[model samples]
Target chain A: MMAVTVITIVLQRNLFSVVVLAGIYSFLMATVLLALDAVDVAMTEASVGAGISTVLLLGALHLCGGEEAKPLHRPWLPLGVALVIVGALVYGTFALPEFSDPLAPFRTHVIPRYLEQALAETGVPNVVTAVLASYRGYDTLGEVVVVFTAGIGVIALLRRVPRREEER
Target chain B: MKRQMVLRVVGKLFIPYMLLFALYVQFHGDFGPGGGFQAGVIAAAAIILYALIFGLPAARRLAPDPIVEAMVALGVLLFAGVGVAGIVLGGNYLDYFVLDGDPVAGQHRGIFWVEAGVGITVTGVMLKIFYMFAGRGRSLDER
Candidate 1:
């Protein structure tokens, strides 16, 4: 369904319709997250990745003069990369343990204890919160830094100074 | 222009609650399905609604450009500063428990504040992006 939406957007001439389709693709990906039992992530994906990000892209289209009639340059390259990646993932999935398997290597690891012990030990009820804020907090800090850098990228892009040589 | 539309009136009613609810989500994240990221997005949504209805300039007036940019930088710096303090206290980088005599209690305290920083920065950055996309002038906000 997501692939259909993306392809529809790519093929469509109307920029607004393409943005709407992109939003739909994001909504579908959020559903996939929910199906995979990552509800918190799904919630974030729905709100941030789908809702705000799509709106941002749409707003950009307004400025960029949307919808070129030209064909995509090197479309087959992307298609080739995507197929190889999908094949790799499909093969890798077969080796993975089924969900909720008690004897799986995942359950035997510290992750299970992290979820089980977070509330009793850290007083943080949400295990994701505990893991993100505690055990692997340094990485979370780095993630925040990445977000900060994105903000800087926008600022630097917006704040372009004209060249002295171009001045009359 | 008889100033009335669903977008305008509903947006007026919803924006404040959205922000308040976002704050609640940020603080209560230790116990619930939400956290700084969720809260930040919710808050940004509220402002975006305001921008969509009233206009980008009014939203920018509510939150100026430089202030927003500073928040984006300062928030991460504040969060990292906490971790750096922990590092200076002779623990691994971002080791929060080292901030107190009891590692567990210190971890909770540090995380709460750090998440707040994340929420603040994210809110500013999201709003800034919205403003940037809508453009710099103040045409659409007053209505």
Candidate 2:
């Protein structure tokens, strides 16, 4: 289903349809993540990817118009770059541990401690939340700061600046 | 918007549930699959839906510019403040151990506050971005 959506998005010229297809793709991706037992990630993907992005893109489309413009140049060079990146990613995946492998390096290192001690340590049943909020909090802080920075940047760039006479 | 009776009615029915779900996601993160980030976006979506149905001016009146702007900064500060609180309490920065007498309780408190901060920031930013994009069309027309 996701592949079909992607194909449709790529072939379709209507930007509006592409945006709707992208939302469908995100829902499929969320389902895949849920199947992998990453419920938290799946939820995030569904909301951020399928929900908020669709709205934001539609707003942008309203501003810029809904028709996909014709490209002036051939797409061969970009296609080559994309294929090379895909190859590299596929090659890198080969080195990854098998699905849910208990003895994977990451699983062996901190997973044991987090699983065994998270309840005692944080009293949180959700190990993902415990890890995200308590165990690796600094990273979450950094993420929040990043979000804050992005918000500031967007407001500065997009909000109407005061007219010069008003400033004076 | 006034002419779209179906949309307005449906939006009114759905907005409350959306807002309620966002809060549920926010507070239930400790035991569930959601957290501040998801909750924030959900809450913002409620307001965005209102904007879509009733028009942007109404939504802006509901959320207000100053409060949304303040939320963006306040969430970041709340997260950092919790870190500083740890330092002040004689633990390392970002340490939840010293947040309360019982380390586990402290951990709970710390995570709750941090998640709240994250939710606030996320909700603010999402709304701000939406407003900017949606309002651009009107501003252009006015100019």
Candidate 3:
């Protein structure tokens, strides 16, 4: 389902359809995450990727128009580079431990400690929340700042036009 | 403007539930499959749905640009403040253990505030982006 969406998005010339397809792709990815039992990530992907991003893209389409422009030059170099990168990543994945292996390095490491201690340490029943908001507080704080910066950037780029007219 | 009666009625009925569910996700995150990030996005999405149905100007009236902008900064400040608070309380930066006399309670308190901060910022960011894109190209008279 996900691969089909991606292929259709690539083949489609209409920017609007591409955006919609991208949303579908995100929804499929979210379903895959849910199947993997990463509910938190699935929820985020559904909301941010499928829902908000689709709206934002539509708004952008309103400004830029819905049809995609044909490329003036062929993208042979970038395509080769992308394929090589994908190949490398696929090769690297071969070295990864088998899925959900009990004796895997990850399973043997800090996760057991977190599972044992997170409830007592954070008083939060959800281990993901405890880790995100308490144990990895600094990282979450950085993420918030990044989100804030994105808002600032969008405002800076888009908000000034109306204010400039007002000044005149 | 020709407003669809069915859309108006259905949207009115649905928006409240969306907002209520967002709150549930926010407050219940500690015990569920949600957290501040998910809750904030859900809340922002509710408002965006409102904007989509009722138009951008009406949505702006409900959540003004100034307030939304303030929320973005305020959330970051709140998060940083919690971390600074840890420093002032004689623990390491962002140390939840020293937030109160009881280490466990302090951890809870710290996580709560930190999550709230994340929620606020995420909500603000999502809404701000929506406003920026929606406000462009269209004039009030056109809507």
Candidate 4:
């Protein structure tokens, strides 16, 4: 389902349909995350990727028109780069431990400690929350700052400046 | 402007529930599959839905840009303030153990405020991006 959505998005010439398809793809990806028991990640993907991005893209379509322009130059170089990157990533994945292996490095790491001590230390029942907001507070703080920066960037780019009398 | 009675009615019925759910996700994050980031996005999504139905001007009226921008800054301050509080209390940066006399209570207090800060900032960023995109090309005169 996700692959089909991506293919359709690539083939479609209408920007509006592409945006809608992208939203569908995000939703499918979110469902996949849910299947993996990553409910928190699924929620974020559904909201930010599907909900917010769809609206933003639609708004952009309203300004730029709905039809996509044909490319003036060949995309061979970029396509080759993309394929090479995908190959490298796939090769790298081969070295990963089997899914959910009990003896995996990750499983042998601090996770057990986190699971046992999070409630006592952070007083939060949800370990993810404890880790995100308490144990790894600085990382989350940085993420918030990044979001803030993106907002500032968008405002700077799109906000209209008032006309002065002499300029008008 | 011709307003769709059905959409307006349904939207009116739905918007409150959406807002309520966002709040639930925000405060109930500690106990469930949610946190400040998810809650903030959900809250911003509610406003975006409102904008879709009632129009941008109305949404802007409900959450003015200045207030939204302030929320962005204030959330960071709240997060940093909690950390700074730890420092002032003779603990390391973001050391929630020293937030209160009871170390566990201090962690609770620190996480709560930090999460609140994240929620506020996320909400502000989402709405700000929406406003910027939606406002482009469509002048107020058109409305």
Number of the top-ranking candidate, with lDDT as the measure: 2
> Could you give candidate 2's per-residue lDDT for residues B78-111 as a string of tens digits?
9999999999999999999999999999999999
Candidate 2 residue pairs in backbone clash? none
Candidate 1 vs 4: which has more DockQ: 4
Q: What is the C-alpha lDDT of each candidate?
A: 0.80, 0.93, 0.90, 0.90
Report the lDDT tens digits of candidate 2 across residue range A1-168.
777888899899999999999999999999999999999999999999999899999989888988988999999999999999999999999999998888899989989999999999999999999999999999999999999999999898976543332341
Task: Give candidate 3's error at residue A10 in angstroms.
Answer: 0.7
lDDT for predicted candidate 2 compared with the true structure? 0.93
- What TM-score number comes out for model 2? 0.95
Q: Report lDDT (Cα) of residue A101, candidate 3.
A: 86
Candidate 4 Cα misplacement greater than 4 A, ranges: A161-168, B140-143
Q: RMSD of each candidate? A: 3.9, 1.9, 1.6, 2.2
Candidate 2 chain B weakest lDDT stretch, 10 residues: B134-143
Better of 1 and 3 by TM-score: 3
Ranking by lDDT: 2, 3, 4, 1
Docking verdict class for candidate 1: acceptable
Residue B51 in model 4: lDDT: 91
lDDT for each residue of candidate 3 in A1-168, tens digit (9 for 90 to 100): 777888899999999899999999999999999999899999999999999999999988888889888999999999999999999999999999998889999888899989999998888999999989988888999999999999999999988776665452
- B26-82 in candidate 4: lDDT tens per residue? 899999999999999999999999999998889999999999999988999999999
Candidate 2 runs further than 4 Å off? A161-168
List of clashing residue pairs for candidate 3: none
lDDT of 4 at B12: 90
lDDT of 3 at A29: 94
